[model samples]
Target: MKGPHRIIIVGGGFGGLRAALELVKRRARLKSFEVTLVDRETRHIYSPLLYEVCTGGLDADMGRASVQELKSGVAVPFSDFERRVKKSRLHFVRGELTGLDEEAKEIALKDGRTLPYDDLILACGGAPNTFGIPGVEEHAFFLKWLPDALRIRARIAAFLEARRKGKERRVCVLIAGGGPTGTESAAELANFFQRMTDAGVLDREAWHVRLVEAGPTVLPNHPEPVRQAARKRLEALGVDVMTGTKLNKIEPGRACLTIADDGEECIREADVVVWAGGIKPPAAWKSLKLPVDAKGWLMAEPSLQLKGKDHVWGLGDAVSFMHPKTGVRVPALAQVATREAAIVAENVTRLLERRPAITWNPPEYWMTVTPLGGHHAIADLGRFVLTGFPGYVARKVADLMYFCSILPWRQALRLWAKGTMVYMRND
Candidate 1:
């Protein structure tokens, strides 16, 4: 009620970062706000391109920069966060969020520290969900964080290295999920290993990539035509597509599955297994005293504020909303989070001014770009679709636009070039 309003934004995913950046942009005009963005990590990962990193696509030579540089090229460090937020009076705190003290308007970190805030923003992102599949937690690799990608890359390279040295006879890579992530990873792995074969590091018939989806088909949310096109492309690229196949269990060096076609049990030998099935709100969320949905996603008013409390706001994968049209909940996505961040910024500023808060409307259209790996991709633009080179170009342009909107122009352009060179190494 006195001096500048203290605002603490939890989570550094797209939503939290953008929200902080938006405040940074208006710090001059809005002088009554002090913002702090808290997160466990310093690097803001470009999740869309994370698959490229996992597949070792970022380890090649980009004209002037190595793909290793490009792997993090799209990522912005917390120091960069400092640069952007410095003049705006915003601060970045690196720590794990353990819980919230809503009664006292404070957030508790894991290291026995708590931050009191006049206003709180939660954007803590989603964690990968294995749907209770056994052994997956230990044996399968994930692709959510930079470390996850790096782990997957290391595993892949090790397998290839062993195979090349004749220590391992064959490799079977099983991907247990058919969403865009799983599909893209399968394609990239096939391409990456194929390059190994081209270099005489792998035998053409020595490795296999299999994708299993419990759903009726891959890309279940996309239009049937887009799904068909992607399916066709994947098959052509030599990724075995197993639709209606459920992952019963995953063990060391193998996976148990139920084939829907025959309703029979089967086991697939595997050297590497990847899980990209689904995601859920952070575990800490379930422990918070805030009002949460049945599945633990925070409940918020249409204004993105806690249902009955204005001091706390929610967005990104941490919150839930009822779809007015379908009467169902929607999954969190980067685009949606970005939009939600904008709304939170507006509403938070309005709250500081004691102005009426604004409501968030679900976006009517969003461009979904799914890279099929090795210079080709598919773009679903709602009414129609673009495939082949146009799709690839469109996605690149979109990436450039986002980077430009978020980062300085020079860094954005450099990232565009860096990403191009990294992916084009296959040629």
Candidate 2:
């Protein structure tokens, strides 16, 4: 508390980045406070558009931005800023964090470096949930990051290319889990295959897209009517929907599943496997001696501060805080992350000013937009749901709105125009 307060934030996801931005904005007002953001990855990925990247509907580069680029955009004055600001001293170390020594207030990195901090924020985000299924970690592809999306795209292209050479001449895609990510990915794959077949690049008879869900219906988080509409839309796109199916195991090229209703076992061969089941907190959090919920998510208060830790805060998918109204844990989504980020920013500001933290109330509009490939989408906005062409337009507009909200108006308009032109040309 004597020298400038050093605030170190781990993970460059939405929560961490937003906190850093807010800290930078308040630099002129504070006399002595330094913020350093750290992450294992070099770039921050927009996780929502990852499915489109995998299906070639959108370029992979469109879904990521370098951490350095993000820093540059914030315009923190280097002269008055902390020395770490010079020569990219933000400690972009690429390694796993081993553990935290609470007594010493230091973070031990895998590379043998210990970073001491006056305050810390954990925004490490979530990992793909494997449900303890065997062979999944080794063989299955996840859509969590840009690399995952790129790998999926490459694998799909390779599969298709191999088919052209009469190698089995059959392609099967099995997408596990039926959340928004899985549903959107399945639709994208169906659309990609349909377009390829229409253009004589792929054979309709040779390609198959299967969506597997353990729940009674796809989009288990959505309302029943919305789920039914999504199912119908997917069916129309030739995606095989297998509901009430629980994955038992995954072999080299096949998946063993048990039907939830009858408990009957079945095996299906797959050329490409995508695991979109769900997400869990990162493995690092499990080893930490901090307070965590039964689900392994960090237990944080409504103010986004970690339980039993005054100097530490948590947010995004890695932290679980119950909703004041619903009493249920808030779902992990970009919108939730954004709202949490603002609250965290204000809380951090208040903490710096020696004032009490403000209460964070959940936003009312928990809307979701799901793309159905080729300028088609489905949207559920709480009270109302829209599908087909109108839904697609709304989805595009919503995407633009999110970008516009975060980015400068000029940049946001450019992205919107570029996206519109690309979609039109592709159509």
Candidate 3:
């Protein structure tokens, strides 16, 4: 008598895609509903490898290859999933979310289209947080999106060309923030420069890659042993690590900061500044009038459903979920988000069948592998740790495991092999 129930998912990120694919796997049993995934981007970019793209690993001249042309190596277009989704009730829509009406069960897009849904999953992720720092928006480069990485690559290429032509004297790169992104980026850039210098491709008296952290140490959230290992690797690579420093402002080719110990102002000249500071929930989240925590992240119950909204669920960086035991908010990591996607997908199926939804209880420990530079990484596996080439291998295996989860075996292996060939050459 009624059409199939509609289930719409906003955002095609780690959690959203996982949820969509999970639903596709259960299409036979969940035949009463159709699924739709909405995202602004046509392709799902592998954000972890963005640094590799920025450091001249993909191409020396990024302008020659359009983002569309380079999509195969680093990103997977939504259309590529159609093979597995053939005859399934899953659909993909390209649109930017503007607003939503919970009462009307409609979502409004910037293009003036409205989509009605019986159940909604919000995985709309975060954006770069500049902390309102002046000149940062215009001067500093970001690595969040594909274009951002290309821009950084172009800048690096230009700087190197100038140095080779005797137009520049030094390669001064200033990276703000000392988390995983900042540390990994700095390491990769250092390796690139070293290779160029060794090959006599550039004529510079010296090169500098400075990593600045406002906190007391780099990788502040990692364990003490991991931090020490990272510091050792960074020092060996000759990266200038500055901790306990605050970046007050950023200008063209320069940055101003203050040393915490002396409380004295300092200025550093730069060839380019890369902003790896942090991220915050997209402003669009607030417009939906959803229940949000004090920091503006959507608040969800233990079942991953939005607080006070039984028909809506939230996941990934868009939601604020505190650990039941530690009472601390979960860190925004791809692994955690993927794990949460499974819970949300299960609960959604239970909801459809009128079964009680199960509560979310994540694992106490998750593996984290951060690639430093060259064939080196720090893999933290609960009580045990691995570094050097072994850790790098672990990181690669972990990546392959994730690729297999989302893509068909053949397509996933092809994608994995393509990336491995492109990224492994640098080592």
Candidate 4:
């Protein structure tokens, strides 16, 4: 309460970055606080396009782009923000959080350093949840980070190259889970294989892509229309959609699954396995002894502050807050996280000024768009939905709008152009 108030955000994901940007944008009104954004990585990843990156859709023309080149299209350096917001009290610190002292109002990092903060925002995102499945932690490839996506691309490419050299007869990719990530990855990868086949780089019958969902259907949480459209697209792209199929375990080059109805255990051979199952809050949160839900995600009130702790806030995938009206927990989506960030920013500003904080209300126009390979997508806009090319256009425009929110127009447009051009190559 004395001197300049220090606001420290402990993540660079959608929520943390947006909150930091929002705070800096309000510097004129608030006047005297420094906002420090801390994260283990130096860059913030645009995760929505990660499936495209792994499938080579964002590679350079002629599909010769290196991993670094693919990375450029998705990773935005934290330093770029400092440059954009000149003379603002926004600082980026790179370190992994290891501990927190709630009473002392300080966070401990892996490098033996502690940062004191008057107000702390924990937006540390979730990790891919393996659901205690055997061999998954050691054998499955996760699509959570840039390096993970790059590794998948490299692994798939190596397999394809082997096929071309007659070293391998077939290449199989098995995707686990049926959420947005799993569905999109399967659809995009199918198209990627088709493109190579069309160009005589691969044989149409030499490779296979399959998606396994433990639920009754793919995109289970979405409306029926969205689910049907996504399933149809996946099938049309030659991806084998196995609904009500539970992945029992994984091993090198193989997967074990059982059909829900028959309980028939089957083993499938796959050269590459991608896990897009689901996400859970990072284990680091447990040590902080913060309030959490049954699933271990930190619990935040409608005001976006952690329960019983007005000085500490939470958002993104790390926190679970239910919708006041629907009584359903808000899904962990980039739009939701960013919107929550805006509300948190407002609430933080209100608290600093001794004003009552405002509640976070879900917007009516919140949309969910899932890419379905090669310029085809499905966009669910609450009461209505759009599919095919129109939906794909909506997805692209949404990306541009997100960029514009966090960046200068010229730079946003440039990044949008780069992504649009490369992503369209799969079409």
Cα lDDT, all candidates = 0.81, 0.76, 0.85, 0.88
Q: Write the per-residue lDDT of candidate 3 for residues 48-94, one digit (tens) a residue.
A: 88887776453344455533334556788887775567665788899
Worst 10 residues of 4 by lDDT: 57-66
Residue-by-residue lDDT tens digits, candidate 4, 365-393: 45799999998999998978989999999
What digit string (tens of lDDT, one per residue) describes model 2 on residues 1-427? 3877777888776676667766666665555776777777665555666666565532212233422222222222322223324333243444557789888888888889888888888888888999899978988899887678778877876776577677867778999999999998899888888887888877788889999999889998888878888999899889999999998888888889899888899999877889998998777886778889887899988788898998888888888888888887888887787778778877887887899998778864588888877777778888888888888889778767865664567766775665455444323
Shift of residue 285 alpha carbon in model 4, Å: 1.6
Poorest 10 consecutive residues by lDDT, candidate 1: 58-67
Give model 4 RMSD, 1 decimal: 1.8
**Candidate that beats the other on lDDT, 1 or 3, i.e. the better one:** 3
Model 2 clashing-pair count: 0
Among residues 3 or more apart in sequence or in different chains, the pairs in candidate 1 whose N, CA or C atoms overlap within 3 Å are 58-67
Best first by TM-score, ranked: 4, 3, 1, 2
lDDT of 1 by residue, 323-383 (tens): 6566666557788888888888888877667789888878545669999877788999988
The deviation in Å at residue 35 for candidate 2 is 2.0
- Between candidates 2 and 4, which one is better according to TM-score? 4
Q: Each candidate's TM vs. the true structure? A: 0.94, 0.88, 0.96, 0.96
Best by lDDT: 4
Model 3: CA > 4 A from native: 58-70, 203-206
lDDT at position 383, candidate 4? 78
